[model samples]
Target: MAHPYVLLSAAVSLDGFLDDTGPERLLLSGPGDFDRVDEVRAGCDAILVGAGTLRTDNPRLLVNSAERRANRVAAGLPEYPLKVTVSASGNLDPDARFWHTGGAKTVYTTDRGAERLRGRLPGEVAVVALGPEVEWRAVLAHLGDVEGVRRLMVEGGGQVHTQLLRQGLADELQLAVAPLFVGEAEAPRMFGPGAYPPGRMRLLETRPVGDVVLMRYVPVAPGTGRLASAADRRWLAEACELAALCPPSRTAFSVGAVIVAADGTELARAYSREGGDPVVHAEEAALAKLDPADPRLAAATVYSSLEPCARRASRPAPCARLILEAGVRRVVTAWREPDTFVTAADGSGVLASEGVEVVVLPEYEERAKAPNAHLSPPPGRS
Candidate 1:
């Protein structure tokens, strides 16, 4: 699937200073702007930065509201967003308060730098190397594949911002310009060294925060050419299509399965197994293929439109045991079983005691009723 698009956001002085040589810098955006930022960060899957910004900014980089944190938990987002830092020159402070100050932090370096720096300091965070050098393609692939980081927010230090913009990797931008100016020839500007051609910006929204003017934009499709990979976009579109196929009646039974990686990416489109067909079910089929030996699933979660079965003649084993054996951390099922052939009310507990998380989403039962109707057998045929 295509990875998430990038959103570049920054607070700069009228002269484009991300930060003065001092740490006591005040935010340019007022309360209104800060709230808007919270809304943006809440929806993001990850936050990114260059080594330079991490060292200079030393930011805590966390959503400030407890309300937001609770909402994130309710929605099944990671307790914290993934923090990613990219470095090429092998220069980084493993002990920099910036990393330890908040959530999980990961380092991206060249194959050469990964070891050299990792060997230099033993920190709680982990490191990922980007080939033998800092290759952008490799970085993006790793983020999308291994990390599953879509919807990335690239916060910056001048050079990093310049590179992504020049390379057309940035999809959207939010720039907050403080009314004040910090003019110095040596100071880095917002974009970076370029006699470069100018790009157009279409304002999405504007607000006066403190004495700052905040402007947001989505690149005119042709401008940055930062298109979402066809695969990634297709998954989202297909999901919507599947969602629309649910019985038109609002209270009708709806059953769906969602397979999500820790990175927030949907592994495979949710679907059914063989003749069982679409409305027949979706979640169970996705988990069926996961090999018991596959370690990539340690952090995966499966959301089903129906409760897991304690009995299934369709296979040698029931999904409840298979899910627990697969080490699935959480299982959310929408409707309970009405058919005697497949019952889990008792055996589901067996798996839960083994540490698997099982949740019954009775709320969606109506949508699942019709699909299981066929399993109910013809009129008096049982």
Candidate 2:
């Protein structure tokens, strides 16, 4: 059930319009921002757009820079990222530029729509059916498992962005703001109305790409949706296994921590006693090895065998404090910290209070506690 790390890319006007109500497509991004987007496209495994975008924009979605394409080829990737689109009815033009320009083309649609698209699409193009509806979750899972897509970039129309964000599937959002306003009510907007993730999306960075201002945001927490995906749970379990690699501790809890980027890459990992510092928490130890200025850290999630310590006697700042300082907004932990060393320690609560999304997968609790079973209190100790 592993899904691709989704990066939603879009351009909007100052007033939050994606396009104007005109016959010609409105250009929201400048040449500099366009090049920037092309670089992002080159780095990703696949580029996706809605069928509406394909019909309206007729975008080729190619890696425009020759050097970037060469770099991808040198890296053993295709000349361009795989082109993907989704439609409910499978009504699409077979001769669209997206079909001819990209290295590979895929269309995800309903079962009925698949039959209609199979004959219309090229022989090399793939048509996948996901039940009676085009589910975003299923599309991503198929892309990750079958298509081998790790980083998926979404160049969207409004509905596509809304669906991904509303479903809580998107990891990062790169929004480029143009310096104009399209005040037409009928104009397409960036995102449709939906119950989005709670709290303000964490702004990672802001840079000026020509007249356009590029802003990056991360979905630090889920609002009403499931917090952790199956892949996230697997990573958390791996972190727990890493804890077993640590030397047994009599005073400190044996714990492990891993920092995973939004793209599912393990950025850094550490267990207790990683640097021979018995007092250093696992999350702190792992974070210390990473550069503080790394922008990826903001979009990364920290996985720990146990909840980061809210208060600690061995160190001035606890693991919870350290994780917050490291700019990690999402944390998935196997078990809540027991009062084995510190009493009334509420690491999960501390993280939640600090606006960090904390997901507890109690299914892995036993595995996480196995390494430190000796530290657990006996029955009736409470």
Candidate 3:
């Protein structure tokens, strides 16, 4: 998977407005802070802005830092990330300076506006429309698939940021708090609205650049950052809940669980459904997709959110056995099987022979148990 980072770079006053409702004007992020914003611009693979911002600031949206540009070139990256804008009503300006910026431009519009806006704006830039309206998921897929943008940086003009945040799409947030204040209630707020899930973001550093104090943050694993004061066990529990949401497969979403590690980077994800062979379980499903021979899974923790059964009637061995044999050290789980077909009890003993530490986060059990209610057996059958 490409590095999915949505960097929210905005200059908001103490009152949280990007700009007032007067004629489109640059509210904050003065010339000195523009240079500061360049660092953020250089780090992302794509730059996103709403059409309002395109019409208002007409930002060049390129990394002008001489040192940063040279480093990006040495790293074999294009001089600039792709520039993207979203407009639903097709009220975009063609002569806007955003067209002549460093990066190639793409406008995400609606199916209704595709032909009309294409004819009106009429430029070399590509125009893509998802459906009747703008679908961010389709847009995200386009960014990752067509544009090859792994890291996406979203500079908001309120509505777009609100949409992204409300849907829990944005991953990182970078705010440059200007010394000035725009107290008008009608001004655009930095973040519009959203129910943010539990995730850890660390302040890489904070420095005063020009009149604004620039703050940079990157998402860490949830619970590792000071910002993550509360643990959203519901989101964490959704690991198995999400697995249950997928169409049922032959192998019951287990026999193929996995944790991918190539270098220190890890990708712990589940397979939705299986086709070619008997479907594997979530743990083995993801693990099977990668080469266990790859060094990545060596030291990674596989949190299956369910106890790996020691024995299964349909499958050869159990996932626990497979995981241990893979040389994985840490296993975090939710439930313990009570049925006779699977009787590993703690199951950690099987892993202990291989010197693995098992952590049972029962908080996730309720989520994993929700779907298996039918197979759970009558309460007092014993």
* 128-227 per-residue lDDT for model 1 (tens digits): 8767678665667677777788788888767877776655466677898878777766665778776321435446888777667888875431111123
Summing lDDT over every window of 10 consecutive residues in candidate 2, give the lowest-scoring window: 221-230
Per-prediction count of colliding residue pairs? 11, 0, 13
All candidates: CA RMSD in angstroms? 14.8, 10.1, 15.0
Q: Write the per-residue lDDT of candidate 3 for residues 31-129, one digit (tens) a residue.
A: 887776787788888899998878878877787887898888899998877889988777887878788767678989898778668676646788998
Q: Cα lDDT of all candidates, in order? A: 0.62, 0.87, 0.66
lDDT of 2 by residue, 166-269 (tens): 77788889999999999999999999887765446667899999999999987644222235654465578789999998887899888989897776566889
lDDT of 2: 0.87
Please, what is the TM-score per model?
A: 0.56, 0.68, 0.57
Candidates, ranked, TM-score: 2, 3, 1
